[model samples]
Target: MATLMAVMVFGGAAALALYALAATVLPQASRIAAVLRGQSGNVRFEPLSSLVRAERRIAVRRWAAGSTMTAAALRPREAA
Candidate 1:
């Protein structure tokens, strides 16, 4: 029981420390991101729809190519 209590206390302290660290760091991260966005002339943050669409298209093409290759490999070859 004592060991379990000690573990709980230490784990709680560690979690609190991590929370404090993120609280201090996130604002700085956001500021840096805003600066980069400003320099790139993008006034607003856009959703990732276009990027996701492009990735899906690439993935579909790769799947089709792989399926074609596997089908060809499994086909019986004629003997000469």
Candidate 2:
């Protein structure tokens, strides 16, 4: 009975994970693969220099316990 219960719990979790991936990533990944392919149908790999870039780094001691994020909002010209 324990083995059966464990299997049911993990299986449901795995199904939900796969569903999330299929919903979010699969469409964008297909477009990226198509863009990277060459005329001969092979994937033309790019060098790391082109793929990765350095961003402005912030020095942080530690992360806070919770996440609170902000988004850039648009207003009328006079608001700025």
| lDDT over C-alpha atoms for residue 69 of model 1 | 86
Give TM per candidate.
Answer: 0.37, 0.41
Backbone clashes, each candidate: 0, 0
| Pairs of colliding residues, candidate 1 | none
Best model number under lDDT? 1
Candidate 2 ranges with C-alpha deviation above 4 Å: 38-80
lDDT over C-alpha atoms for residue 40 of model 2: 42
* 59-78 per-residue lDDT for model 2 (tens digits): 12122312333343333356
- How many backbone overlaps does candidate 2 show? 0
Error of 2 at 45 (Å): 23
lDDT of 2: 0.62
CA displacement after TM-score superposition, residue 14 of candidate 1 (Å): 0.2
